[model samples]
Target: MHSVIETPMYLRAAKAAGMNDAEMKAVVDHLSMAPDDGALMEGTGGARKLRAAGRGKGKSGGYRIVTYYCGKDVPVFLLDIYSKGDKTNLTKAERSTLREILAEVANAWRESARRKAQELRRNDHD
Candidate 1:
């Protein structure tokens, strides 16, 4: 299973959507096991829209989670979440912004991993 990273924006959105700990955990667990579970969203830099059932609500009236999973190496990113009643789809501007943000996130993760590997090698040589 891949690791899941919940961004502050996502956390805030989840809370705003009234998703409790158990609900949040269920989403994370599902994403970890199947990072590519959702439908691919176009123009959003590989973002996917996943339907999550809310407490006492079915998937139809639940929440929509926006996730980014670049590859198996990079951890799955929970970018945002919103109630279905609040918003059904992202605007064109929003999609463009998400694309840019995802590009930055992927680059940052690659750089961090590279630096960590270099540090480990240096420590081993010392």
Candidate 2:
């Protein structure tokens, strides 16, 4: 079985964002076991997005998945869990939330990558 590494930082961020344990666990399971396809889990927001990239999940359980690239080969990091709005229009609040979530995830991914790199370097030097 493949092992997924969700550093404690991820859990902390999820908690900071008000994600209950169950919800965070669900996303982690889905992300870890997901096929290695480069499927795009596009963002919500609207038709005129400037820096937006994740969409909100609708009633069907499909939500926006923002991914942060770790390296040239590492699997993209799953950002956050977002619930969709009522219609085609994305409220200002929703967009702001989406950006905030993605930023947080990106920061985490970068940090993870740095740590992993440092470990590898230390191992190689030894």
Q: Find the candidate with the highest TM-score and give its number.
A: 1
Tens-digit per-residue lDDT, 23-82, candidate 1 = 999999999999988989999989999999977779999999999998988999999999
| RMSD of each candidate relative to the true structure | 0.9, 8.1
Model 2, 45: alpha-carbon shift in Å?
A: 17
Task: Please give the lDDT score at residue 122 for candidate 1.
Answer: 100
**What is candidate 1's TM-score against the reference?**
0.96
- What C-alpha lDDT does candidate 1 achieve relative to the native structure? 0.94
Write down the lDDT of every candidate, Cα atoms only. Answer: 0.94, 0.46
Model 2 poorest ten-residue lDDT run: 45-54
User: Candidate 1: which stretches are off by over 4 Å?
Assistant: none
Q: What is candidate 1's CA lDDT for residue 20?
A: 95
Candidate 2 per-residue lDDT over residues 26-64, each given as its tens digit: 655654555232333345321121121222433343333
Query: Which 10-residue window in model 1 sums to the lowest lDDT?
Result: 52-61
Clashes found in each candidate (C-alpha, N, C closer than 3 A): 0, 6
